[model samples]
Target: MSEVLVVRGEMQPWTDHTARQPVLAALLADVIPANRRTLILGPHSPLLIESVLAHSADVTILVRSVSDAEQLTETFGPCLHVVAGALDGLKRAAAVQPTLFEVATDGVQPFEVVVAADGLDRVLGYDSEHLSWTERLAAVRSLATPDAVVVLGLRNEFSMLNLLDRRPAHLRHGDDEWVPLHDDPTRPVSVDQFQAALPWPAQLYADFSAHTLVGVEAAATARPGHLPTRLAVAALESVDTPLLTSTTEPLESAARAGLLPAVPTSWLAVCNAPTPHTLYTHSGPTTLKATATETGWETTVGVVTPDLLGTVGYDSTVVPARVPGGESVETVLFRLAAAEDVPGFRKLAAALGEWAEDSRVLLRWDDVIVAGDTFAFGISGWVAPESVDKDDLLAAAWLRFHRRLVDGHRRHPWPPWMIGDELVSTWLSMSGVTLVDPTPATAPHVESAYAEQLAWGKQLAAALSVVLDSPEQTHPDLRTQLADADRARLELTELQGHVFGLERTLGFRNKAMKTRENRIRELRGQLQKATTANNKIHSSRCYALARRLAQFRNPRKVAAKARRILRQNLNKLRPAS
Candidate 1:
């Protein structure tokens, strides 16, 4: 008796960002037909699986656990044959015809399409320790029939985001249980390395952001963003100033190899393995080359390769929504000029949009604000032209601020707001010296006021510029006061140093006095003791006899000299008359 596959009915809703159902649905819908027998290695994108089910696609799902298989069967119904087993088990089952318990072995001899959308990381583990990427690839290969199309998704180890953001987005986990413990390869393989590892011929596309995939031969490229590839590349390279070897090597390799894209956050590879499934028919070259024309930019946006250009031609109707911003006028002009040359006006338009935005919100609101002086005014629809003279605009804004101060003094008695460079840039978009516009309206009076403001603003801005450029003459008294303050500070510092020195000297003196007092007390005690001893000797008859004998024994001249010396010391101690 053979054991039957048991499917568990309980499973949680898929929550991983990597499980991008919408994108997978769109991609799979284009490639897989309604009636093809499909084998899904992992139920990562349930939406994709459900979408294909509507097309009456014969599908077999292979899952890691019985619970996953049961949950999939419960959701998808009996139409989905959920097999709870490893890749090896599935391969063995594929060789046999349907038995009493065999599910997917019925009509279809082998699966025409095999998809491991969860990627090799799921199978081999990201750390590359559980199984080699090559081994995982072979396992995916074995699941399919001789002519099966395999769709895979892979992670780019050397992406632009990984280089710029220290903690890259990939590091984040979908859930606590799904934390990616697998470390990236110590030496990440490049496109060439990846290509070399491929079991078959493939075409790779530069897919931006996440959700990139690897497909079998003749795969279509993903949609490009508002920024064109050429422009995007230039922008990234120009700003990659701190490009370390880790970053530079990948970029240089992509450029030098020519087959790989220079600026995508991710990539997709389409392998060439002949399959019964027909690939989606697409137009345009796989590559593009942007060139400047007299009126606008001429960009060839189609399938372009290093050596070959595909049938698709450049589309002329595209335009950039905004222009890119830069620190300097030269940079802005350069980007603007580049945008003009590109076929789509999208880049130039994006930059223009950004410039207009800057003209409105350049000022940091709180910086120039005086808490109680002026009411806050919001500006909208502020647009800047290509040739903006920032200095002229700033000066005009400053002059208007000054005018408001004067007008307020006579009418409202409110102080004028302090103008800063940012504020000047912001208000310069308005008509000359206009303080505020309470309503959003286009009146004839407003237009006239605006023109007058511009004329007056130009003059005021020029005058303000002159005032700021020239150094103001200092008052003689102010200079003298500053000098006096400096001298006072020096004297104070010196006095502090002296005070510290005196404190130290006093401490030493106090210590010496204490020592001297102790010494004097000790001498007094010794004198008292001597007096007692002498009294005792004088009272005793033996002492008097011995003293007389000594006096007689001593020379008379020595005694006389001693008496004179003692009298001299006694006289010296007497008070002066």
Candidate 2:
């Protein structure tokens, strides 16, 4: 019994598809008044529409494609209304032209909650009159009741994704982008402008996909273990966009300067609703939900199924959640390091060392919350798989933090030249831990994870380390450097193989030379013995007369006479036979 109303002149052979943003849908669900009329403008994920239906049975979705409307109607039979029309034709007073049909909204009631999270880009049809961004906003506004809770999604043209995108303008869009109103003068480009455009007070959020939605203020002043900081890190680390360079350093700088909200991929404006500062991130297959509280963050898994930690190389026993009432140790340590407070940093390190000595699980600074002398774990469900030595655990934790610090371009008290194992050893010494080599054989999984993290960190660091003379110059330079390094490594490997072959050839040649030298020495010794024997025979008395006769001028004649005598002796012997 679902209603599918079609306004003639709707766009044909066109279906607008939007990405499914679960966290945004969850936020919208939280704000949508239960049992009230709701309006969803533009194409949204079916999952999101279902979430909307869960709160309110009376809902209407507007899309420009008749096929899309029919599909939605079939999917949600009797639960909601699907309207197929352009925004211009949705008004009750729309002109009924001969060429185009108008939608009749006479019986439709004003919506109590309005959601246009997909934004205003796809709300118009090809046959409809062109409308400016402001005009579209007005059209959407005209559908809602006064004081209605409205959630609007606005795309940031100056977002890091857009700025770093290397795609040509023509290639960046699809066929559906034929009538993009990017140059509309009335469009709100920033959070401030977006808020000003709304008639009601609105809370602005940086929507970084389904995993992260950070409040403007929270993002500006994010600290370690804070929901905004954690979620922002997770989102940045998980970016799949092919950008010319990493946005990690730029975003961190923006956050420090309180300009992070101005540069997100998109913004969400929620009016007349309470918004929780939260993070929805995944660890392996488990979804983690972290919400900010007055004391600290409370984190729990979103879906409670059978334990999957062991499959993901995590401890089977889930760590119990506790509301740790304190600032995170990471924040304090970072503050101390940035301020160059060596004594304070060392003292805290020593204290952390003392506490870690008896701890059963690995202690990451960000996971440890500190209130005066008391310390508690802030994150839950991250435990060591097996018992680990105190020193080894400390080394792993500090070394991982070291990589992050260097990779994130964070300032520290240590000298700039001190890096890698030297800095880690120095930090460990301050923590009263000896610098023993914790071989990978001792903890293979942890070591492998750390190695992977280190590699990623190094790559990120290299990508972000270019001089800021100009982005145009620096990005290519970094790429060139990476390519050159790879080429050099290949050349080195080839050279090593060549050198090995040459060494084998040289060894064979040396052996051959040694054998030839030994044969020459043996030949000389045999010739000298033969010469000594010939001299002894000549010195004999009976051979002296024969030697004198052989030395006569007729030596050839003597040889002929000897031959004749031998022939005669042979003839006499034959006759006797």
Candidate 3:
């Protein structure tokens, strides 16, 4: 068995530029093997594969979403597989590469929550006390296609250690994974189930010394683990989580799948009654009807004809759904028939064959049909049992269609029938199926009342989420409102732009005016001082000329006046000019 290596870390955040490149780069670096069929699963892996096509390795990469990858392949095109419908996308991806390396991307179709296989036994070592999961890995390898490997990628975006060190207000239980239900009755099966979800469970869970695992079977006598079923779970639940895992707690990590409550056995039993559904088979289709008056409501299941599927098409409220691409299915309308009235239902189904040409119709009468007219019919609806064989009905139709050819087979013999393939396949699928050894506890020993209470609690929680995040559900009206909100936001942004522009213009104008005003004031003050000095010098020159004229007549008087005039002129010229 090829060793499964789990490489996990906090990749870069989902940003506007590249939400998940580091994660992809890390995966491509570690997971890819030469000449091996590797399935890499992520929302953005197609984008990464687009990058990977440049590396000319002889590797065939089967992509999930073909439309998304088709554009990418123009640049880098390895072998590509893209499903038309998003729901069937992953299944097609699996067909291309049987083994998968999954990066858990939220909000993508065929949204795989877990890549872990269902069954594996934990091997216990005497010295180390670690359960060796090599057997489990081997089983997975056997189930995997030839030359393929399964790898599950995990990302812890929020560091639990960070929470522990800082002791953030949001952190719960101080970074430790706590358990509420310690003495769980079904502890035997816990490790196995938990390990199945994990790529390397035994090694990963070996840490955490706080977990003291006291075997549930030893502790509880009445539990089914001690009985013949031997089915149990080493259940773990945080004491704080059960007490305070409120509706408001953040999921914290992208890969944190919220706790999925166990399917209590009693609820399964109560839901499963051995009531066989009445079925009508024809050439093309098998129809089933089961109508029982339960809690005063008429319960029904299965289709009346080729046209009417139970809930998918019967209600006008449901969106019309179909597989993408030109798939062959004839269009026909069906009138609801009351299945409780068995004779009326049989009559309705019989008449349907006559209603169509060449009596070319097959109908599956799965439920009881009561009263119905030609145009309109009433239905008695019942909850479908889990064991209802849908493939059996399809097989019956195929068999009927095969038998039609048998009449003309003397002219043309099918080698499959003549060579004996029909016998082998049918016996394996539908020859009064029976298990070799079954236990009474496997029949479901859970109490119905307790099971109902848990289911009610779950439903209540679901209802609360719907009520809180009702706006987020992709309903038509909600989509319209969201679009309107986006438009309004754009308009507001434009208005803010205008306001910013106006503010900038005002600031520029104010600064320019202040500069101009300061320059004008300084210029005016310098001009005034220059004028005053010029005027004072002119006066001194005039006085000196007058004194010189007077001194022409009397020498002594003239000398005295001339000296005084010269001194005054010198003072005025030196100081003012």
In the range 1-577, model 1's lDDT, one tens digit per residue, is 2222533221233322334445345456555656877777654657777766765467777664555656666777777877665444554453353542233534333666776655555432122234446666776765555556666655565556445433335553344224242464421245565666666565544443433222211112211211122233322433322222223234434444442343455444455433222111111212222222232223333323322121111222221212221122222222333444432223422333333322312211111211122212111111122223443344444454444333222222212342333233333433222333434448654533234435534554444333222233232223335656897999999999999999999999999999999999999999999999989878998988777768775588777988999999999999999
Off by over 4 Å in 1: 1-18, 54-56, 92-109, 124-130, 164-188, 211-266, 272-577
How much lDDT does each candidate structure score? 0.43, 0.69, 0.29
**What's the CA RMSD for each of the models?**
24.2, 10.7, 34.6
Q: Which candidate leads the pack in lDDT?
A: 2
Ten consecutive residues with minimal summed lDDT in candidate 3?
A: 264-273
**Alpha carbon RMSD to native, model 1:** 24.2
Q: In candidate 1, how many Å is residue 505 off? A: 37
Score residue 153 of candidate 2 by CA lDDT.
87
Which candidate do you rate higher for lDDT, 2 or 3?
Answer: 2
lDDT, residue 258, model 3: 19
Scored against the true structure, residue 243 in model 3 reaches a CA lDDT of 22
How many residue pairs clash in all the candidates, one count each? Answer: 32, 0, 31
- lDDT rank order: 2, 1, 3
Candidate 2: regions farther than 4 A off? 1-3, 92-109, 176-178, 223-227, 276-303, 306-349, 357-362, 366-376, 384-396, 402-577
The better candidate by TM-score, 1 or 3, is 1
Write one digit per residue (lDDT tens) for candidate 3, span 536-559. Answer: 876796777876676687778868
Return the top candidate by TM-score: 2
TM-score attained by model 1: 0.40
Displacement of the residue 401 alpha carbon in candidate 1, Å: 24
What TM-score, over all chains together, does every model reach? Answer: 0.40, 0.68, 0.20
